[model samples]
Target: MRVLMVSWEFPPVVVGGLGRHVHALSRELAAAGHDVVVLSRAPAGTDADTHPSSDGTVDGVRVLRVAEDPPHLEFGTDMVAWTLAMGHGLLRHALTSLLPGWRPDVVHAHDWLVAHPAIALADVLGVPLVATLHATEAGRHSGWLPGPLNRQVHSTEWWLAQRADEVITCSSAMRAEVSALHDLDAGAIHVVHNGIDLRRWRSRATAPAPAGTGPRLVYFGRLEYEKGVQDLIAALPRIRRRHPGTRLLVAGTGTQQEMLGTRVAEHRVRRSVEFLGHLPDAELTALLRAADAVVLPSRYEPFGIVALEAAAVGATLVASTAGGLGEVVRDGETGLGFEPGDVPGIADAVDRALSDPRAARRRARAARARLRTDFAWPTIAARTAEIYAAARPGPPQNLPRPKIPTGNLFDRTP
Candidate 1:
């Protein structure tokens, strides 16, 4: 089977988990004896050097990165236009042809960023379009579109749902949310949880951080408001009271760094809290292996890939019981959970993880086993291929692309 995956983010140009998800999935599919081609964007200012096939081979997956002008025009006004430009590049290649005259059996797209071009390109190629909604615009903004940009994005997501032959989401929670938000049948959505590369993490875990007397807690992901890193910070004081000399490591960079840094200063926990901005792969794996517990305090996570990674690296997981995270972290079983903004609850869970290493290790063991059996990429890729097989391809033609509603306008779908 030849699969063409279209996404805006990919390795070395990732904004979040979407790129990693696509990379891992494509690699697994290629390993399973399938021809996998990824159509993605090249980083800014490198268009001259980048080629459609310049990315070379990433674990057997062929990448065709298009070098387009950076979409930095006037507060995201040109985002949709830029996406169309990317789609046009993809469509041109599909028509003129990939190397060796290879064409796609199916077109799989991730998120709304590439939806416009992906749907159009799939139609042109007369191939089945498999749309994976990693997260929805409405879901990200807490059930409201807020402004024009949000509304446009939400509309595109809804349009993708109606346009694609099959829609795949990361979790049951996300499936239900998309269904309710877009007024679509729940049965139309397929729930496929994101996966991690187990061997890679395990190899990087060869040298865990040296053992220290203090309990080391780490949180590595985007430090945004919705991610709830501040909530984890709020819990630190109580956590320290119970377990003296406890230290926290906050990794990743985001808009919330300044605020979080300020909050840390105000709380005067500067010495204990270290903000290591965006760790490299080897360093991240070591940190995860060394940490006593990993905290994921996300207020809105469609699916927590970090949780799966942390669990795979043998870190005791402590996460928020919200969104798809609840499905990932089974309370007192695979890992511990706390309410979205419950500082005290987070503190208690962290204390339990630090205080009882035996039980935490048991849970970590359970999580690692689950990662191998349930969340493995080969299995996930196979399941995704099944969806692609089920979808019937059709020629490119004009379809109903209703104007997406905007600004808290619910209970209506055009």
Candidate 2:
């Protein structure tokens, strides 16, 4: 099977997990003897004025990165405009011409942002369109104010989900959320948990950090609203008191940087909390190797890949029990689980990592071993391919697309 995947982002130009997720999934599919082509927008090419194919291979997957102008709209954030313009650039060549040439058997889109383009591709190519809704607006903006942009995104997502032959979600939690939000039957949605790459996250049982020093507790990801890093920061004052030297490494960049930095300053634990902004994979692996535990304070995560990566890297894992994280982290086993807003509980989980060194190491080792066997790219991609083969052509009829100006949308379908 040939799969053309449309997504807004792809590494090393990733803003979040979606790009890496698509990258891994596509690679897996390619390894399984499927021809997979991933279309994305990024700015790394010799030709500045043209869309660069990037004509390279990643774990058997072929990636063609299209170059486009900065997606800066007047009324919306870059995120909003990028979503729509990501698709707009693809139509430089007519969809009618592009689809037949690519000759894809399946048009698989990664999220709502790419729905329009994917639907358009599937329609033009006469192939099955499989829409994967990694996260929904309701889940993303549950506690925050959802603007017109979010509503428009959901409307387009609803249309694609209903029209596509199948909708792939990250977990049962997400499946339920999507079903309710789109008013679709739960059975129509398939739950495929995100997988981690063990090769990149491995720690060869390295030597520990200074003994008796407060253990290193790390959190790596975007400092976005849904990440709940603020909650973890709030719990830090308590964690610091129990273990004076316990270090907290917050890796990743976002709008929340100033607020989180101020949090450390206010708590007078500026020394304790190290804001290691946007670390490279080498740095991430080193930190995971040194850390006693990794914490994910996501308020809304479809699947916490960072927690999985931490486990794969031999870092004891603890994450909020919100959303699909429960499916990945087993309490008192592979990794610990805490309630979303429970600051005390968050502190307690971190304290447990600091106090029980041997047990934590054992759990980390176990989780790392599990990830090696279970989360390989080829395995995950093969399953994705199965979903594509089983899917039929066309989205279900009568699905509604909420209105948002195309100016702010990522038009997945040209």
Candidate 3:
């Protein structure tokens, strides 16, 4: 099968887990002898004409990175305009470079960022469209479309879900969220969990800590509010009182970094918490392996890929039973679990891990073992292929553009 995957982020241009997900899936599909091509954006400041857009073949998968159109639009301030420009560039590239020579059996879109181009390409090619909703705007805001921008994003997500021939989500929780938010039949949404590559994340031997060193807890991901990092900070003081010499190492960057730092100072646990900012993969893997416990305190995780990373490195996990984290970490069987935003719960879970070194190691070993059967990339890719095979092609037809409702119904009256 020939597959064309549309994603905003890929490989060296990764912004988050979505890029890693697409990279791994595309490689696995290509390795299985399916022709896979990924359409992604080039890195910032690349000369569009000079830099070769097509990276011939990467791990058996062809990658076409398109440059953003010449515009002074900044994504931070003008997201909708920036996205529209990106979509225009992608559509133009597809029409000129791909159509005459190669065509895809199905067009797979990763998220809302590339929705416009994906929808347009699928319609033009007359192929089945497959969309994966990594996370919903409503879910991020805890089910409230508070502002105009939020409503716009939610409407786009609804349109994408409605237009796709089949929809895929990373977790059962996300499937339900997408169905409810978009008013789509729950049966139309498929749950395909994210996967990990064990080869790259194997456990490494770490040098032993000095006799008086504290227990190191590591949190390596974005520091956004929804990630519950501040809650982890709030729990630190309580954790230290129970077990002195319990220090936390935070390694990530986000808009909430400054606010989290302020909270750390307010809690008076400043000395115990060290902000390491963003560390590269090598440093991060070493940190995860050496840590006493790797904490993931997400409040709205679609699927916690970081849990798999921690498991692969044989690190004991202390995670919140929120969204997909509940599915990944089996309470006592895999690692300790806590409720999201529960400061006491976080402290208690960490205390349990520290109190029993043997039990923590045992659970960590179980988590590592489960990876071979449950979170393997090949198994995930095969399941995804089934979805593709089941997708039926249909003729392209015009669908009404999604409308965002203003508070006043008569605002548009002349």
- Find the candidate with the highest TM-score and give its number: 3
Ordered from best to worst TM-score, the candidate numbers read 3, 1, 2
Better of 2 and 3 by TM-score: 3
Candidate 1 stretches greater than 4 Å from native: 49-56, 69-78, 204-213, 394-414
List candidate 2 segments past 4 Å from native.
44-57, 69-82, 94-100, 143-145, 202-212, 395-414
Regions more than 4 Å wrong, model 3: 45-52, 203-212, 400-414
> 249-281, model 3: which lDDT tens digit per residue?
999999999999899999998888888888767
TM-scores for all candidates?
A: 0.91, 0.88, 0.94
lDDT for model 3, on a 0 to 1 scale? 0.87
State the lDDT of candidate 1 residue by residue for 1-414, as single tens digits. Answer: 989899988988888999999999999999999999998877644543453335467889988777664444322456666667666666555455463477789999898888877887787678899999998877776667778777777878888887788899999888888887766788988999899887777555453454357888899999888899888888888898999888889989998899999888877788889888988788898888888889999988899989998987788999998789999999989999999889899998898888888998999999889988779888899999899889897656565655655555433422
Candidate models: Cα lDDT each: 0.83, 0.75, 0.87
**Candidates' RMSD to native:** 3.1, 5.1, 4.1
> What is the lDDT, from 0 to 100, of the residue 153 in candidate 3?
87
Task: Tell me how many clashing residue pairs each candidate has.
Answer: 0, 12, 0
